[model samples]
Target: MLFFSIYNQKGVPLLYYSLQHYLSLAGSLIFIPLVIVPAMGGTDGDTATVISTMLLISGITTILHSYFGTRLPLVQGSSFVYLAPVLVIMNSREYRNLAENKFKDIMKELQGAIIVGAIFQSVLGCSGLMSLLLRLINPIVVAPTIATVGLAFLSYGFPQASSCVEISIPQILLLLIFTLYLRGVSFSGHRIFQVYAVPLSVAVVWAYAFFLTDGGAYDYKGCNPDIPSSNILSDACREHAFTMKHCRTDASSAWRTAAWVRVPYPLQWGIPTFHLKTSIIMIIVSMIASVDSVGTYHSASLLVISRPPTPGIVSRGIAMEGFCSILAGLWGTGSGSTTLTENVHTIDITKVASRRAVELGALLLILFSFFGKVGALLASIPQALAVSVLCFIWALIVALGLSTLQYGQTSTFRNITIVGLSLFFSLSIPAYFQQYQPDSSFILPSYLVPYAAASNGPVHTGSKEVDFAINGLLSMNMVVAFSVAFILDNTVPGTRQERGVYVWSNVLDLVNDPTLVADFSLPRKVALFFGWAKCIGA
Candidate 1:
């Protein structure tokens, strides 16, 4: 059924398919900066710069993963798995009150934390610890842990989109229709509408929002159009001030202020400041990220190769992802890189699993990164419209997480109870910590208030560092859900079949079927170079 198989290298199909992948990934590629930069007190220029850097790192890492890692056709990018932890660090007590060089200082702290965590993750994988850890992970554990990642931000997604319903609602509706209803519609023998759903919806809604702004939809009679929202004195105008800011397509100056071209480099923000508390937080988050990637690796291999990869191959993929995250930390992309969960969905929909297409798409991402205006243009997307897309994305993540349970005994009482409890407590426990915030004066937007649990939560262990680390980890829904599920699934388990322990193809299988060796073994020259490492599943 595949239009292009894993090794297919037709030049024209490669080019067309690669472009399709890039367009599908564009919104999410630039999403992190739009969410985190403003919270860190960064400017539009900083947002655009981070977006560009992320694109560059994603491209490089995807290519690296294709060559040396699992060699799957999966793309690597900034993952939301790192987002909750980063937000926790950003909203910590000391940084909360900083008045000078806030953006640079925060970026440096995050960089240090990410580097330390990435190093730990690299050791965990390269040293073969992940293979041991895999024995404890099952679909029951993975299901709720991954789902909580998406559910953690329920407060933020739609509420932010509601800020400009006129634009955001239509955007959400259009995207749904394109991806669901009109998905069957095709052009020139290609499902162009379905393949380009995200960008097409954004373009249409963006133009409509532009017309609204140009036609004075939010103009106030007593307000000066040029004045900042904070400076507007009229009470009547103040009511509509937030609307104008979010609805107006010109609200951000990223495009006007950005340069024609710029290359991102290491330590562009400054030398990182290593702190024990933040580093500890990121280390734990990195483990969660690895757990997230494990499921993706299994599912993607099944979809592409009809067999699971050996544990050692999964380990190498995790290690390579950690190395890529190290690069992201050095360049300060503000989030770690991982095999995107969306990659599985993309392959399923596109029916193309060619490594050449992914590599070519990555090169296109790299080329786009060099254009400062490309990142700026993405940075300039209206906040509400962006939030609308995120709502759908987060929902999709939830669905995908649940879908993994299909590989297991989904109808079993044990699996259902474990998943339900993990998800319930993940939400319930975080709510308790977030509600315990003692400082009422610290006012953040409603959605961000959940992430502010690090500052004034009830965990008081005397040592500020200990308290910060504990409180921050507890506040993250993924960490809590993972701990619960890992414990329960390991201890109160039933049969291996009941637990749905993933059974990877073995060395004997590869030897019996020479074709699998071609599918998974290292390139011939590289395999010869690392013959001694065969015990590690290289």
Candidate 2:
């Protein structure tokens, strides 16, 4: 199904493939900033800045990963893996009632935590500790761990989208139609509609909603359009006020406020504030991100070159991700960069595994980041539409995560129980912790309620930092799932075949095979210079 193989450098085809990749990046990649920045009490302009910075960091990190890491065509960006912990950090007791400088304070905290976690990840990978851990990371551990990430957001998805059912419903329906029903309909030998499903669905439904807005569908006679929904004094307008914010095409002022051109630079938010509590939270999250990226790398390598990269290569990829995340931290993205799970699906759909094309697509992302309006325009997308897209996206993550079970014996009772228990406890244990010391006095948004336990959870270790770390980690679905699956899978007895062990290439075999060397080895000069460090994937 490959339209272009891994080494293909043909210009026009590469350009087309790159554009496809870029379009794919537009939806999920931009959604992170739109969700996170606002939740931190940031302005529309701040949201736009974060979006642009995410793009820039994504582009830079992906390019680094392709050439110097596993050498696969995986894209890197801000990920949902980091979303829960960031929310916990932002909603902690110390930050709950900040009257001023709220956004910058939270962002700087995130940056410091991300930097510490990134450094830890770098050491983990560069020291080759990751490869040793791979033996315990079979499909049994990965399937539920990754699935828990998607399931973690179940409360947030529909509740947010339902605010503007008119827009959100149509978006969901249109996207489903394009990706499912109309997928067979091709254009000029390409499945253009299916390949561009997210963007196309957004466009069609966005225009439809624009017409509804312009036609005064949500207009309230006495409501002040400039004020927030809570400020509406008229009872009649108060009910409709909420609708105006999400349904209106111009609800966000990002477009009006963002400059025409701007470039993102490191430390733009301010100097980060390092804290033991936040750093511990992110360090755990970084491990989950590494595991998530490992799944992506294994699958993408198969699509690109029909074999998984060697353990050393996987280690290199993780190291590169950590280094890239350091850059993301300095840039204050509020999230770390990692290999996107969507890359496997993108490669399967487009059949464009060419490294050159991926690099070109990354270059395009970098170029687009310089245009401040691009970020503003993306930020201006209606909240309902963004959530609608996320609903489908989170479902896709679940599907993809479970699909990894194909590598193992999915019919086995042991595998099934481990996965089921992990998932059930992942959600259930968090609920118990979250409800242990519930605060009835503070009113928070529906989406942020799950993370509210960060301020008043049951875990009291005397030391504030220890209590925070325990509470925060336990509250995260992915962390709990990963811990359970990893421990059970390692402790329980099962054959390699039954466990569905990942078949990573041996370092000796990798060094011996010329083809694999070509596919995954470091650049010639770098390899020669760092030959002494080969034990650690140098």
Candidate 3:
């Protein structure tokens, strides 16, 4: 085991880990500006202010997630799951055409939803009801449910890659080359090759941006001569006027207006508007985030400590995620925080699974976010490059989702169809909705109409509450896919082993978990006094 002053179990300082930490932190940090720039486009705040809020909330929550929450080394940072719904809430009819006030109100509604979701998650965690919520999920259900997370983001990811096709294509190529071919290779003298490959590849692309923009550190002339001195990306270097210059970097004249230090106060954007549709959507997304965190917790445990996560750990981790979500909502980030398997993937690349190193990295993320220049620097990144990086990130997530299928032991056609069909249709509904927004032709059956009415999905009777529910349910693509798979997977005849639930369901089996025995010892005693207590954390 490695040990150091910063760490006790591992004594020697592995500079590789320090570098790896920074790169991973930087990679996730870039997304803050990337996500914010789009929302704030043609609106308020500069790169520094937006990034500061993201870093502030993410950093604080990450610390809680690491030390107090799940106590896992997993980094709690930005998430894209809320991206769709947040945009939905922002564009809701209530706030439309409201001008400058629209931006503030939209942000408020988003924040309100986030806070509501957080409270729901906290109760799920602290009360131990989350386990019950996921008891029915198996690999087949999980397969498509998890896959949906990535599939859902394709719309957002593809647009970024398209912004500058030329810049993005090469970045995608390099990311694939590094992650696929070189992540495992090591030179005769160098052993940390796999670990170094990811960050090094990302560094190359980032540096490539500087050269592509103006050759070198504002040489004011890109290195490429043949591409065309007048090319949109290249000429930005020579003339200092980029076709997508702002997209490339966060440096804006507006950033100069940023205060040296910023403190993100609650309701800084505007008064939060509580809408049923948006709130429920965030709650569902937070639940999805919780489920994702379970996988991350399990993966982290297995990868680092060489074992599965105990029920107790899983419970606490989820509870912590809920608390962090509360923080995100209060901070008004328009989204909640969750653990990313990407951080665990980083450990695989580096071969250094040092918990202290990871925790320290989270701390650094919080601290550096205060420095306005850092956000400005990140802001300077080209949009195409950001999109290229997102493409790489989402591809990994897509693969991560697919990898869950291996545990299903999907040999029989019966099982294969379940997985395939779920994915196909899950993908279909979202694509259809994207292609054509909800229209009058898409009508629900009479029995289901009540739910649509309850959620106010399609048909509206002028009740905002009714309409909110309708919109929230329809917008949630994963719910449709998951319900289909869950119903089919459970009802279809397949032996427990064939379904992989024999092993996978152990994740849900609380009776045999010793840690859970101790955890519930006090609760069980308390349950004797109250019948509902049995269900609270049972």
Candidate 4:
């Protein structure tokens, strides 16, 4: 009996472990083409290669965290939201036309800022400040804000779906029909079909689109096989080093020239530098990242844990995100944050809560990060495949947001009003800003616009007004909206309830518990020490 008990405790069914590993890997891969490629664009083979290298690094780190750290079934990658802001800062007309030396200085400064912000996040996790912030921000407020993210992304999906050159009306319809058929069928056999239906759907779309184009002449050999250019690789490496001075003079010519310099394995770009601007940006990034993490944690806790996450667990997870961001900065990637929606999706699909699995995945990501060649190969995936994946993921995000509304109590006029207006302003204000922005030529020389214009060139080009519209709709500056929502949800005359939700109580409980104290890992203790030091200093 004793031996049996020990064996049962130590053993995991092989099939279960295998499925979990594959799911985690698939989740990581899906984000590469879906989120990363779309934001980065397709033309710059060098940029694509570098970004892929970064993703590979991030992937390996994720795998390591999964294997050796938390071991949760989660994967990490470049965040889509950060793309717009970083691009705005890096290639914006405000900065791009500056002298090479100035550009390098600014880039270094920004890197510094990011590092500082990451440190701040580490502190927040360690000191349990995140929990306090959560307490102050009511769920009513959080729900609508999160919902807006979904609503904002939802607008992009249809356009993206339609924009795929290969995905025609009939093909999409057929794919949808196939998806429905798969969904309708139930079996006791291997659940792989259900588990990977979305990816399968994407494959069908890609296959159909491939056949439709070039009369089946769209073979792999026919695709562009040249590697990215050395100059492009060098520039990307320099940028990662925070040395922007060496970027190509002619942006257009450079892109065209460096279209074939793809290195197959991960190459080390020099370490990142830190600066004030980067610090500020990192702060913002960390805050947004924390918000995203909170949302994901809450969602996952509700779905799987069936209770609010203990403070120690939450802190550890958040600290991991901060650590990942630091690693990201060191490795010359954008930023790293906990992706709640993605996490929730993984949890829902896999139904595995073992931290060990996530750690394994993180270990895998760490290994991949070193392989530039492998990164480049992954980057070579077709763009159409990416668009399809995002369409499905974004749709899931929307569904999750709607699910939160089910938790609300009173369907009061004030509640309805807050939700409505928050959604509207969050979507509208940014759109307006992007639409009326002066031409890049007006701000900088026409030659510099492609490389300089922060929003990727002119907003009002021809009949494609959707660019401006979508930009304005998806803007994230919803502070005012958040304020208004908070007032309506918590401070309105009749809105206050008998007992308010204390989001931080969970953290406080963990911190106060003597038994829980024993579970604190070495990293968590260090995080706490730094957090305390920062608080005292402040």
Highest TM-score among the candidates is held by which one?
A: 2
Where does candidate 3 stray beyond 4 Å? Answer: 1-6, 9-19, 25-27, 40-44, 95-98, 187-202, 215-242, 245-251, 435-464, 502-510, 513-538
Give the per-residue lDDT digits (tens) of candidate 2, residues 103-147: 999999999999999998887777767876776798999999899
User: Per-residue CA lDDT of candidate 3, range 284-354, in tens?
Assistant: 77877777777778677777766665554566677777778777776676667888677786666555666
Rank ordering of all candidates by lDDT, starting from the highest: 2, 1, 3, 4
After superposition, the stretches of candidate 4 with alpha carbons farther than 4 Å from their true spots are 1-73, 94-114, 153-161, 168-181, 184-190, 209-267, 270-278, 302-304, 367-373, 441-490, 493-538
Number of clashes found in candidate 4: 62
Residue-wise C-alpha lDDT for candidate 1, range 149-264, written one tens digit per residue: 88988988899889999998999999899989999998876787777888899899999999998998877777654436543777887877787788888888899999989988
Give me the runs in candidate 2 sitting further than 4 Å from their true place. Answer: 1-3, 6-12, 229-236, 505-538
- Between candidates 1 and 2, which one is better according to TM-score? 2
* Top candidate, metric lDDT: 2
Error of 1 at 16 (Å): 1.3
